[model samples]
Target chain A: MKKIIYLDNAATTEIHPDVLNEMLPFFKKMYGNPSSIYSLAKSSKRGINLARERVAKALNASTKEIYFTSGGTESDNWAIKGIAFANEKKGKHIITSCIEHHAVLHTCEYLTKYGFEITYLPVSEKGIIDVKELERAIRKDTTLVSIMFANNEIGTIQPIKEIGEIAKKNNIYFHTDAVQAIGNVSIDVEKLNIDLLSLSAHKINGPKGIGALYIREGVNISSMIHGGMQEFGRRAGTENVAGIIGLGKAIELSTNDITRKTGYLKELRDYTIDEIVKRIPDTIVNGDRVKRLANNINICFKYIEGESILLMLDHEGICASSGSACTSGSLEPSHVLLAIGLPHEIAHGSLRLTLSKNNSKEEIDYVIERLTAIVKNLRELSPLNK
Target chain B: MEEYSKEVIEHFLNPRNVGEIKDADGVGEVGNPVCGDIMRMYIKVKKDIITDVKFLTFGCGAAVATSSMVTEMIKGKSLEKAEEITNINVAEALGGLPPIKMHCSNLAQQCVKAAILDYRKKHEK
Candidate 1:
């Protein structure tokens, strides 16, 4: 059996052992509904409360402000449509960026049909939204501004604090999808003046199907899901006990080792980028170098498609992702790449290799070796190379 | 990752006949830039039989491997028989693709049919 080198951490990280350990009790021994009023349920409620507090402290918010959801998409939908529908009488205007995850973009699109006007701010070639442009786009009727803290594809970290301040000045509700940023970077909701925030556990080496939204106290956002009194009636579903437990443990572990692990990933990421660019010609790194995620490296080879590159890498036992996994089967280039000003040809050739603590320098070197050979071979056959 | 069949991994690791044929009898290209895959196929037909076939593909490993295998399968076969090659046949040639990567084999089959159509169009004219 060939040993596989897994590098596609951006899609989802392997669940940490500690997180799994923390969740095991909930799945078997401590199986009690938090909503139930019994001694067993008390412990479950306590676990949920403790997890909420840990998450809140991580974001510098109150535990009462946090409401759990399935994942980033659910949190995003609740924040956008929930706010838009609740405040429709006040204003029907919303603002977001072109590079936002489809969760936010598609929700906004749905709102547009209901008479809400959306202003999608454009990013520069490096995939950073202009704060000045955002300020100029804001009108008196603009009720909400939802921007992602970090882009999933390009890994560009936005100026969320500055954007939050602008939203504050304009007295608009600010929501940031921090699914990719939560464990990777420091986030102080109060410091950033963020009104609402979204996060997912899968991005931080936790189990999937568990996430949370931090809505500031007194925010007028309505619930998208209706059911029995759950999540303070804000998000209605039986609490995901095992998933939430794993998420809490994952966040705790991530926050504890964030500084050291981030430094390690940054070193490995830079080394990989340096090696790739040194060996390959006409390759451009996507996203801003300085203001990007520590784990993400998105690059576009001038004349080769990313799918081909990934396929060849797979054969070499190295795993990675193209710009958009959703469009991998289709022949179309990534919309995020197109939005960041890549030409259609270059966009099709984008590869995103995200790192994690599990990745090592030796693995990165092996990847570079295989990638170089594959690119050279594929480019030789590409008519566009000439 | 699941254990891939030996043939699938073989084609992926050592894809055969990958590249374009210059001045070919017929050419066919599929997949758009936005779609994240592009395959260009060239055919050299002699007396209504495909004497040689080659493919240049910019896609995932399965796509490149499928194209390579498709060309190898069609070479020396009559145009009518080559045109009958289906996605199932191409996938089976590799012992089977992942469910997600099956589309790549489908793309390869489409390219073959298209190339045959192009040959028929030119020869009839």
Candidate 2:
């Protein structure tokens, strides 16, 4: 088999060896349930507590503020629905950006059925929301503002601090789905005035089924899962001890030297973007270059569909993702791309290559070379090519 | 990505009849870029038979493979016989496409029929 070049790190990452090692003990010797009263279960409880503490420390929050859940999608569902349900009496209005993940957008859409009015603020062509627009969208009855930390498709980071301040001044709860930004971007919940934040472990080289939501100490959010006393009675489920331990270790390792890790990824990302643009004709870079994630590169090649490019790249052992309608199950192009004012044709040709620290310069170089050839060959076969 | 048949992958990686015939007797174009797929078929007819056929397509693997397969299937056939070819035949020739991509085969069939129609329209005068 050919050696693989995995460029779809944003989708999910390989579990770190250290994280796996930490999790293995939980599955074997420490198999007792944390909810059990037996002495054997004490170790499991300790493991969960330590994991919570690590997650809290990464975001500069108290241990009590973090609650474990299934993954980013659940965290998002819980955060948005929790705040919406708890404060509906105060206001039935919620404000969020149009470019959020389906996890958040769908939740907001669901609320409309319950008599809640949601305002989806628009973004600029670069995929950044206008702070003034968000402020203007806020209403007297607005109880929550949910925006994503960074876009998963285009890697555009939002003005989180500004949004947080606006939410704070309006006395509205601020929730951000930080699934894509957690390990790469340093976040301080208190400093940023964030009321709630969501993150997933899988994106940071941890286990797939575990994630956390940080709720500020005084937030009045209702329980998303109603069951036994777990996650301070806010989220109820049997503790995923092994997954928790893995998340703890992964977060610690990723955040311990985030500056260096992000700097290294930024270099590779810049090199990849510059090489692709220089070698290819009519290639348009997506998102804000300066405000984008360090590891993401989204580009559009004119006159060709993204799925063909991805298929040819896969033949070369390079894994990437695209926003083309043909690739996604839905017939429409990516909502995130469309929200940024991209025409449907241009959106269908977009390619996203999210890097990881483990990827090497040699791998990127080979990808650039193959990508240039693939684009050229596809253009030759494209009827739209002139 | 959805799993594709080995034949589909084979044809996509090395699509056949992948260019245009500048002086072709008939041309057919179908689909739009907004839909993430488009195909243009060109044919050179001699004595009411398709002596040569080629295609250019911008789409996913399925779309390109279907266009390639249609061109190969009709190269030596008469215009009326080529018009008789259906999307199902095109799909079966390619071993079968995923259910969602069945439309890509339809695009190929429509393109070929359009080309044949174009050929007939030219000779009607």
True contacts kept of each: 0.56, 0.92
The single-chain TM-score for chain B of candidate 1 is 0.92
| Candidates, DockQ | 0.43, 0.85
Clashing pairs in 2: none
Residue A258, candidate 1: Cα error in Å is: 3.0
lDDT of 2 by residue, B1-125 (tens): 46889889999999999998999899999999889999999999998899999999989999999999999999999888899999999999989889999999999999998898888898786
lDDT score, candidate 1 = 0.86
lDDT tens digits, residues B1-125, model 1?
A: 34457776677667777777788899888876555567888999898899888877766667777888898899899988898899999989888887877888888999988888787788885
Q: lDDT (0-100) at residue B119 of candidate 1?
A: 76
Error of 1 at B45 (Å): 4.6
| lDDT (tens digit, per residue) of candidate 2 on A1-386 | 99999999999999999999999999899999999999899999999999999999999999999999999999999999999999989999999989999999999999999999999999999999999999889899999999999999999999999999999999999999999998889999988999999999999999999999999999999897989999898888898899999989988988898899999999999999999999999989999998999999999998999889899999999999999998888778899888888888889899999999889999999999999999999999988887
Q: What does the interface RMSD come to for each candidate?
A: 3.4, 1.0
Model no. 2, DockQ: 0.85
Q: Name the candidate that leads on DockQ.
A: 2
